[model samples]
Target chain A: MAAPPPAAAATTRTGALTVGLSPYTARTSAFRRAQICRHRLPTLRCRRAQPLTAAASSSPVFHGECFVVGENIDTDQIIPAEHLTLVPSKADEYRKLGSFAFSGLPSAAYPTPFVAPGEESSRYAVIVGGPNFGCGSSREHAPVALGAAGARAVVAESYARIFFRNSVATGEVYPLELAEAGAWKECKTGDIVTVDIGKAVMINHTSGKEYKLKPIGDAGPVVEAGGIFAYARKTGMIASKASA
Target chain B: MTMTEKILARASERASLEPGENVWVDVDVLMTHDVCGPGTIGIFKKEFGEDAKVWDREKVVIIPDHYIFTSDERANRNVDILRDFCMEQKIKYFYDIKDLSDFKANPDYKGVCHVALAQEGHCRPGEVLLGTDSHTCNAGAFGQFATGIGNTDAGFVLGTGKALLKVPPTIRFVLDGEMPPYLLAKDLILQIIGEISVSGATYKSMEFVGSTIESLNMEERMTLCNMVIEAGGKNGVVPADETTFKYLEGKTSVGYEPVYSDAQARFVSDYHFDVSKLEPVVAKPHSPDNRALARECKDVKIDRVYIGSCTGGKIEDFLAAAKVFFASGKKVKVPTFLVPATQKVWMDVYGLSVPEFGGKTCSQIFEEAGCDTPASPSCGACLGGPRDTYARMNEPMVCVSTTNRNFPGRMGHKEGQIYLASPYTAAASALTGYVTDPRDFLM
Candidate 1:
């Protein structure tokens, strides 16, 4: 396919940026254009610049610092019931919402805050957890809190089913199940990691090792569309499919 | 197919069912409480736009149970948001706070979502019920396929009145043999969870069967199904029997088709337990699956005892605890909180013109035993409500409770050690200030 015009390229790069599409082919309506970008551009800039597009990307890749967490890190520990209603009705109040992330965790449980106060600006793209991560309550606030606190994805040995679905449906955090046993042990806090959703692979850049992830199946499209609502809107399942 | 599979198939309008097959099932009732309701409403408006109307207002139930008693502006603000949404949407089933004059007044509240949903007949046989709270599985006692979903999914259901569900495999649990008087259904479920571990039945259905389960009343059956989520089960179902029908009689006019599993239906795993071998069990702190017999934890001292929640705050539970307290003939040795799950349950406990109480209710019985009965029928201290909640722990204290989860910080303090037990065990522990077996008090 021919390269798009520079104006179109700029628009695609900055506007209507769907997942897995390179800025060069942004105007192309063909689904195969996303596939082409996936194989050609190993280090894609789309996800890093636009996190919203990461969910529906044909080949979504996320790179970030890992925050190692232990098994059964429940919803209450992530964001306690006390802070559940801290949700902001407007964008300006998000910092207040993010401030309470992991506030519920006892100081003795972690050496430092999961996301320290005033450090919400610092990006912690990935959360690495042990078995049965997000085991308690079905509050989507756990993942919502993490997303607002600047997490792009989570790599865990296993996840509680409700948390896994909530993460996908909210398009808040990409939940990647680590297929390799003890894979999380190889990485430490502050270690940089890269997750390739299409290939189902995780590369720990700090440890210089690669780990496999379980296949996400049909749920991938829903996540890519930035949640079930977006997917339904795009597919004309509900009315007002054209509007955002 | 199992009863769960059959229910799913009928809701999805399918002739047969297969595990892991995603099908869109029509929802009979969708419930959301204060904590998750505002978020669901936000997503609903964002996805469907401001003008979009809910699929069916009558089918949606909104109960403001959690965090409603708090003076905190944010908690009260959540209820206001839900109230406004109900007013805007013209939804009639919104159970609002009845008495604003006193937060403790067992106001005109319906109760905890799970308990009220069943008690009010929203959970019908062969139907599908969804709630934003995880304990929504408590509705499975009525032989329905009930499960919890997130705010986004709930929002979708609000617009579509349907949810796409993957039919989960079923695990059969059969309780046989004679029952011991001291052991409640809570003990039996705790033992089952202990054996199964926390995630033993993740994404699967649990069907309780056999003569022992058959003998349990509707409330006992609800207690059995309420904690299935603790075991990572999608739902816990009991086949609708005469007891189920009797409970539903005159409560609802909505028609329902009872579902039952074929005699030879296959289950992924089957477990048989004899009630005779069971003892009063308590799930120790940090995890609901970490369980031991009440006698095993007898040495552990307790600072408080709580008898309430969707799991343990029902009328039957109150009666069970009252029986122990009446027998002890002593004031509560430790600070104890007595919460009835619903206003109806509260009225029953207080003997408020209830003929069955014979002029003496469990609340009166507990008052004589020096227990603090919070008048309002909300989720008091179950989800660790306001700071002044009746059973909230301020420091690293141990509490034997009749609630479901025993996770860290689940009941106010992170260091608080919570032991999950039946109301009988909770009442006995309240009298002794330690984790004592109910049998000791009864004997």
Candidate 2:
């Protein structure tokens, strides 16, 4: 929109290596150029053109705009079984994967899009939910879809046990449990929020409020390592324990 | 220690155990179906590398039950990915769709993964079974420490044949006194869930004790354990008895030593239930724990009736429904779909190969009663299958179903309502096109 950010255009021409765009630079750059050129009017151009990719961070601190949802948000509403496809394969085409996150949520009820059209999923990194988030189905795709959609963490009053375990085991997204008192009430959509896993607290930058969250406990190291395999490899358990 | 504790201790190779202690245990059987298999295979390949082989091929079972009959290319592709992985890995327990000729045709396929896991004897007593499906806890009926895991954890188990688990505290549910004639295991479980309030047993094991539990058949016990996840339980275990051994008689060749709780074993919480007073129950729309007596919700209208899934599609479940429908002398008022949980159940219901029913099966009885019987054994409309699935709702429909979960939009359209009930209640409700208690028809 703002003249296609000269640097992004230059980088697109050179096909320079970027953090998340490294794998699909050529294809993404072409798509970006087309999207930029197609929108002759500044208002019509995409706001955030950065490929919505998971940024590899060294620390457990995550900061982003919050997307708030209500209680008992089941897995089907997160990502319906119909949209679960092998197209663009999850390994190579993450943007495609992220596009369908929360596609199952009935659009007529919540006019606010979970991942708005033409907006980069990178705009949202935190999800705020009421009680019993991820309440139905053992589908790991629920968290995977959210993670792929650029959610770094989900803060809720409670989580279904299987969903909690799946989130921790895969390290796809951090599931932070908050107390029932004012967890969901204190946060609103698009509120700037920072979740500090090390401190076990979530701070709302918009409202200047702090909420206590449950500690990750035994699952902390695994999530910090970005998944069980990475944790096992780091702790040297993969060779001994996995082989046995 | 309780039976769950003892099983976990032995699996993790520990001399002792305690609640809330994290420990790694070896898995005996691991299963993944079409809906979750592709993601699991993708994760397994990405993490363990393409050349990485599963820990044990024979111990793993891959079944394509969901999204099988649909014409959607994507759903079919999901199965293709599983088939490719199975072929590449040379896995022996992979059950594939034999015929894709017609969408409505009865394809050659094994039943639902959870039912097949038990029927095929993969879920042995005193062992651990893990699957990518939440209903994998259904195997705990055999006195095993079984639980459902997501794809990533399942991938880890696929590559390593082990999972890290925190030993959950055991909650003893003593169902005392004799069960009433009309009360099935479904009624008892619904009553338990209503009391527990869904999140009551979060991260805990539920140990079923007392005479009422012991009196239930293996299918009934499996049904009880299958829905423990509905109440946020880690697993539901029934101590192995002669009934368990008789059920497992030639199904499993693997030697197993039954595990039981010590007489003085401490439980985190103990509760007692009088099964004799239990009545037919239904979980209202939007929540499995929002339970009410079936009679209380009898005035609610319905558009369809679904009787299937690992929780309610067994042979005994079918027989129960047939008993009610055969005696009613009426065709189903609304569309009624009958799906058997497994191939054996299907055969038994149809009196095809099983002579135990004197060649007159539940399928014949239901067919005579004007119920649509799909030949394949699958989890249709249970977890809400594809658009063309036999029982899926197209609009805002209210259905009385026998599946475990009653989450909103679970069976089909987001506006659709589902009421969870037993097969008997479901059949009765289907006949009247409304929520009617099974007793009313029986009387």
Candidate 3:
């Protein structure tokens, strides 16, 4: 691995601060005093890390143009329930993934949004729909399937309340609000848009309009790393040393 | 701007938005059932790789409601796969048709997550919730924002615990006058959807207001909120109040907490409706969006009446059907089947109070009539159940069902026409064998 960057080392030291490592020791191993003396910072203070801490994760950040769609698309249309059974394994191994999962996607994959059984579609990372994006049952698999298809966020006129929360609770999908879809008509699916979760901002390249949104409660870490799983791993490694 | 736009704006703390944007938002809870989990697992593996741990498995929920009985070998395999996956993941909440201790562990499991969450406490006022099914919006009855997603979304949430959201315009359904007796929210929503067409309110938030809405019980309001999607709205909101809190009290985990819209809460566009003057409504076959009055096309003949679904399987809905059936006493022209949404509902109506399956208690009235014979309490052949199929192609078989949709082939063959109505109307039709309105029987 490449040598850790100064910023990366600084963050590591800050992380160690919460678990009770002295800043001096955090800068260098106890057995390596010369190295520790060279890197120790005098001003840093140790304190318990904040609950639901935010961290940079390895997941890729999605920022590009934007797209839009109409509303009230039911779960069946997203990833039809009938198709749920065709996956190769209970664990999803040996199955074709991506836009092919749903009938809808760029033509490059499945080429058709509605295919007979055994057909698939291309996958899109972001789906910008009109209001009531998910307005059906309490099926968590909807968002899960959407996430697995590579959707990082769903910018819509609005979300079904249940779908909105479920998306966040499970996959950390960004539920951005577009008061109206006028700008959406100007955009199309696959259009790139910049989604900055830290600022809760979405800049539609097509319209040049910037929209603000609500962040997941204490989800800064999850969004920064592109999602929660990435954050958990980083947190797990840090917590391990504290235990030791 | 429409009512959907305004409702979204009021709920929004962030700046105004345009479609095609993305941003993160807080998610109060995540819910899933086994009906479509296998698809999610498949996608998770493909995208994140097999070795990745399911992040935040505690927040994840999985229930085997769709084919809990496993009608065939393929179905059984589906259930088995989910069971094994949950075991490997060490998932905490798993409910089978036979083992339902988790319901009580909830201290207030109303049945399905849509209703159960509102009753149990996972859905709080002014919060966002998502589920894999359309009825997930039922929590909106409690003033929380809720909607349904799909399997891809579910898979992502399960793997990463994140989701994307979009803001929508708002459409206001203003109500006036009194709700006709026995008319209930189901009938009213059918009327609204008919006026707006199946996709009329597409991509918008529906804020139900007016004296009529204000007067409804939480159960009735939930019926309205749950069907917002049937009309194509993203989500529906009922401002919390005394009735809201009162209904939520004792029945849910977050009991007696009052919530409401701000006095200066914003709105998009508002429309008005007079329920008292409304007639019994019906949606023609092949589309839940195709609606008309029961009297406009009473000439249509019928073959079956299905009275059950998350929308129509509630105790109140059951009671409504029973009253209509008992009063008529005479079994009419068409065959009828009552499919409850969950086993608990089946037991509630059958009068069997067993403690093992959520609530062992059954509804004596229904049980006495052999109501539990439908096999399972979910989307069972309701999507194509045998009892509710069309006799022949081009044959007119009218069905009064409490199920959410009335699309062609939804119950059986696509050629047959299906009429959507409340349990009351369903029971009435089951007796008359022809299209009959509940009001006609009342007099």
Candidate 4:
């Protein structure tokens, strides 16, 4: 049988579908294509993109770094069931998940069995992680919690595709390109790492080298609009102002 | 492509679903327990409010299993909110803790939806079901497709009665022989997960076939189906057969619509396991995927040994444990906890002392052997009740339980290790203070 032509591939990669004809396929028969297309890889980022706004600059850019030690850190570690009972709104949800680190909590007051605690790492803007970062169930809460905990970006050798997408989609948990995450494992938790997410650059203060990172796709819009809620609010404000 | 890929390929309404392809699926049923109900309904109310009446109320089931007895005001409020919500919506199956008495009055109640639905005839073979709780896949025993979803997804289903589902491909498990006398369905699943690793079945639908599933009673069948998620597969199933028909005969009473795989049906991947030669398997602490033989399990000192869940809290499960207790005529080395998955099982099938080996109801026998009262509000510790972790670390305790997913810090403590096993194996381990095969107690 002849190899079928490439299916439709969508343009702009906003969870859209686009199909392209392959060189070898027959002209008359149908390929029955799925329009849902993923982004070009290695450079694949989250689904939103916008520019850095003035308000973001005023924050002075929170910057610090730490390492997530293990692989397959699931959503439960970031948020426990006990905390869900307390809050009703989605805005407060991330706060609960971020506060309940399972082990190695940077603070003495918070001692949970699962999270690792050291050097207020959660307060850091950049998180240097090991292999298979965020490998487990697809709880968008993991990224939500990390972002609420003040993690501006996650720099790992590799990331679970779903977590990577969710982090970027939410305009937080930025995935950075760290070809060798192991090398940075030795970097202390409080080490500072300068991040220019737009430039996809990370300067490890201790190592004094600029490490390349993947820009969170599409998420630029949400980040520019100040997170998903902020983005929604801004859009609403624009729509209301325009209607008036 | 893997077995999972093939299964998904066959199931996809779309032609081909490459990796990372997101496609929507047509759903069959949506279910939730009271734990998720508060949040799920809250979201639904915020999103749709009174307009939530579009979805068929009969299709939704709200069970109050978690936090039924904590007497915590929050827990009470959660339960009350779901009760009122279900009433307002005219939801058909709103099972409360007190409903345990109704099921006890009628032994047909079985246990969690995994067992109860089979007895009630709600889950037919070859159908798909979606539930808010991860273990909801337990409905796969009767060969139905099932999985767990989040509160938001469930809320979506509750409001629109539809979801954006991507049909998961199928992985076929072929069981070849009759189960050894000591080994049962739980071992079969444990062995499968142990072989494939924790994430092996991730994003796949598991289909169990062969002689082993054929020989299993619906209860035993539910045990295997309930644990499919441990393999990373969201749903597990066995095609409906004579066993299924016989089991469902009077319970559901609906006109039978038998669904089956075609004789020429294809599977993405095929797995073969011999049940006859198998010994009991145990998953060591921190991960249900962690596996070892009953005898090979070192004397992991015990803090608690819980034997109940949709997986192991059936009548047969209770009977299996009782047999071991009778055979040993001794108290367990540590706290041997037994929370019958359903009140029906607890009141009628279990909770009695037989008088032979001290003749206690299985619950009483367990109590004598150091078990606690059935957790007040429902399947408590199994779903994160306060009992899972020891009060303090350095407590030096290992809990041999039948609950799914023994991941690290799962039982609320990193130090606590949970061993997953059949009820029989758990009882034997409890008696010996070390992992012991059920066959040893058979003599």
Candidate 5:
């Protein structure tokens, strides 16, 4: 649309070596390419063009400003039920959903919105939260909305079972647990943070603090490969969708 | 091994499996509704090819229940998406509701997926069921391994007929005592959630047992299992007995084998409750674990009463509400809404006579009590689908609802106040315009 940013062509060639993941391509074409890339979660009739290969998707690190929420932030608060009619698979609605992310968080308590009014995306690429985060309803929209809103990861004290699993399965957002408790107290909204999964620590650039994190364990590889379907395809656990 | 372990072991074709071991098991059924079906279908088509067939047409059940009867374009489009996908896949158990005007016009339409799943006999003992909706745990009433999964897992199950799952350790909730006519399964579950907080059972199995559970009916058992998700449980199970067998008879053609917890089965934790001593309970607004006794909160005023949802919308639940209405012998002081969980339950509300009311149907009792006409069976206002949904709390009024979870904005307006209660409590509160205990009229 906008003449495929110069970084788009740059990413295709050396995406594997770009650890920080150049903002332009990793933020857009990574998922857009998933639609046509046979190796990633196959989209409708996966295309055969210059595909965004699996190497481009396995970006091992994430760094951005963090939006923060409190304990027991249920799915309804993440993406309310009234907005669930939006089909996450459709590209346009997926972007529209990003605008409504965290719309349900009470305005009185959360004065700072995750996505500003009328904005399709958020300034934050990471979210910090308290215990029992994403604690209600199994709607994948909760994670999908966060990822669509440009959130790369959520570091929290703990997570609900279904939300954590859905995040890993969809490869929408990374759900990481902080080794030390009280991440909510230590972190605040609009904090600059960097998450290094391999190092198992989150660095708060704004506060000049470091917090240890629990490993993603078995779920890391799946999310890195861009959801379970892609991981299964790469590991030969399931056949490629295009060849099926 | 516990009953859950046995069922998981069988599903995975393993001799035995301990807690925390991840294993790939064959899924017996994969259910999706209007809310999640479209995304699941999209994923299935995407990953399996646009022309690919479902792994087993018979095993995939699609129910268009949520967001139905609403005029929202996207909501209606979601149902259309489900219909198109079902037609494309030749899905054997697609419950379609074409007539939004009159649900009766479409006889195959079932309102709520969980209740419909049980009535249609898709739930069986010792089998594994994975669904896209959170209340899929409701089917564990039949002593099965049933749990909710997101769309991605449902899509995977649709294409591969398998799910890689970690076996959850079982928590034993043993209830035993004499009959307590004042209490229902809703009260029992509320009491349990209060005792063990909302996330107490997260990532674990809840095995319900003892003479008290054995004495309840199948619908009551379903009520017990339905809200396990509210407690973050993987699933909740009650061993299949004569009650379960009697209910399943003539409902399904497939054979099923029920499993039981061994006498010395290991449990992560054990809780014992005496049913007779338990009081009617309600979970206050904003959270399901915010529990309070009904009698203690008698002064709290309410604007309306809603009696519906997978947790409390069965024929028996209506009958229980009717019993309270008939006992009070007074018109409702507040607006009261009734929504049955399925078409069959809807029929029963009008057809089956309430023995406590001198042989009158629940509809007749509701009419005499001056409550609103029974809306078509659906998930009405339980999670508040669209702004125009029937009886949705658009005004932020205080209401006593017979549904699970009163989380903020769950019923509609973010400021709305919802007190989750039993049908009996809902009916009693309807008569007084306040949170009244059923014991006042029943006793």
Candidate 6:
């Protein structure tokens, strides 16, 4: 598949700052303050409050420090049922859900946490996770929370069907599969990594190593269009916003 | 073609379908409950316009189940959203609970959406169902293509009356031989999840066949299909047979064209199990795939026994639990909480008398065994709703529950340990205060 153009639809939808940036380009010149109004990654160190929120889309490339997690990270661990009461459709509740993302993961095991206490968004731009990453419940809030938390993408060995679909359907995160299994085992949380969706490569800058990713195939176009709704409008499969 | 392929083809108006091919299909029924309904409704209004009506009011089902009885203000308010949507659209099936103070006052109340779906006849063969909740796969027992979708997909379906779906390759499980009296469908599913691990069937369809599945009744078949999500399966189905036809007789007047897998059907893989040889089992703490036979875990003590959920809290589940409680003639060693799946099952516990027990109701037997009165249904404590949900694990106590999924913190407390067991094993464990085998009482 070819590289996606800048995500105008996504930018307007969530006001997220991810520009699908190129890792090779100099940040001072190519990377604008991206202002990242909301959902900026914890690693971006954006001090500005009330930033835009949106995830890393398939608009070619984006890189950031990773948030590492273990196997069987079910939806409960992603966004616990208690917090599921907050609807993702409403902007305020969507942000509230992000604050509580990964609240269900046992605190003893995951001491660092996905969203720090009293913090609105995560510092990590991407999630490096193990197998069965989003197992258990079919709550779409799991991915929506991560995207709302400003996490752009997830690289995992495997994913639950519903979680995978929800990620693509919401266009919240780039759910990528690792071609080199257990690649995440070598990296820890806060490891800087660059994801090139066009080339299907994930470069771990902290380790100075690069890993391969499985092509997302047919689902790629839908995600790039900012989920099924946008894709439907784009392809004329459904009526456009103006007509509706 | 596989049954799933056939169903998809029929829904999509295609002559054939392959596993990887994406196609658009008409959604027969789209069910949502309080937990996900508000979000789904919000999205529908946002995308389809505030004044836009659903594609078909009759095809949308709103059941207030997950947070129905909770006192949490937001959870309570979610139901009101569904009420307003149903009222505005004039939806055909809106199982609303108007009186939280008295469930009896609301005759339309149905506890769990999945079970209520079967009871209310929203589930039919050769049809397609997409719900906001994952357990929507529970409707696949009638040989339909039923699977769970996220609120986004459901919202889109609500507005468009169709969804883009990929046909999943089928994995056939042939369970032959007679089921032992002590064994329940819960044990069988636990065994499958154990062997296949949870992700074994990911992005695939699981089709059940053979003598053992044939011998099972409609409710038992539902139990098998309900946990397909646990295996990461898109759906699980049993071919529509007399049992399914009989169950649908009074439930729906709408005629459905039930389809069967062709003789030349191709399966991705196949598994065979002899139900007679399979022992009662449980999925222990933090994972549904962590399986251990009931007898193998007999030394592990527990603090509670909960019998409920779309997976196990049926009329038959209560009957099976009562059988053990009656046979033991002993008081429960720990707190044994009973929750029927739906209001009808609750009514059954109180109204229906067991013939083998000489006409004593399950409630009588449960009371005689020192168990808590069967609690009002509505998915109580299954996913650990608001802190006040009935029978929710408030502490880090070990529990033997008939419900599905032992994922950490699933019931309530993050440290709580859960053992997923059948009603028979759950009852016997309640008597022994450990993971006791039902054969000890059943035999």
TM-score per prediction, in order, is 0.90, 0.88, 0.63, 0.74, 0.93, 0.93
Candidate 3 Cα lDDT to native: 0.56
Stretches of candidate 1 above 4 Å error? Answer: A1-57, A88-95, A235-244, B103-108, B352-359
Model 4 chain B worst lDDT window (10 residues):
B387-396
The better candidate by DockQ, 3 or 4, is 3
Span of 10 residues, lowest total lDDT, candidate 1 chain A = A25-34
RMSD of each: 6.2, 6.2, 13.6, 11.2, 5.6, 5.5
| Listed models, DockQ each | 0.39, 0.32, 0.12, 0.10, 0.48, 0.50
Error of 6 at B80 (Å): 0.6
Mind giving the per-residue lDDT tens digits that candidate 6 earns over B97-144? 988887878899988999999999999999999998888999999998
lDDT of 5 by residue, A61-121 (tens): 6655678888889999899899999988887787777788998888888999988886777
Candidate 4 lDDT (Cα, 0 to 1): 0.59
- lDDT, candidate 4, A56-131, per-residue tens: 3322222344444444444444554444343333434434455554442222322322223432124444566655
- Considering summed lDDT, which 10 consecutive residues are worst modelled in model 3 chain B? B385-394
On residues B1-443, what C-alpha lDDT tens digit does candidate 5 reach at each position? 99999999999999998999999999999999999999898888788889889999999999988889899999999999999988888999999998899999998999899999999999999999999988999999999899999998888898889999999999999999975888899999999988888889999999999999999999999999999988889999999999999999999998899999999899999999999999998999888999999999999999999999999999989999999999889999999999999999999999998666899999999999999999999898999879999999998799999999888888988888999999999999999999988998899
List ranges where model 5 is wrong by over 4 Å: A1-59
lDDT of 3 at B263: 48
Candidates in order, interface RMSD in Å: 2.0, 4.4, 7.9, 5.5, 2.0, 1.9
- Which candidate, 4 or 6, would have the higher lDDT against the true structure? 6
Best by DockQ: 6
Pairs of colliding residues, candidate 6: A37-A51, A37-A52, A38-A51, A38-A52, A38-A53, A39-A150, A42-A122, A42-A123, A43-A123, A56-A152
The superposed Cα distance between candidate 5 and the true structure at residue B337, in angstroms, equals 1.0
Worst 10 residues of 3 chain A by lDDT: A24-33
TM-score of chain B of each: 0.97, 0.96, 0.83, 0.86, 0.99, 0.99
CAPRI-wise, candidate 4 is incorrect
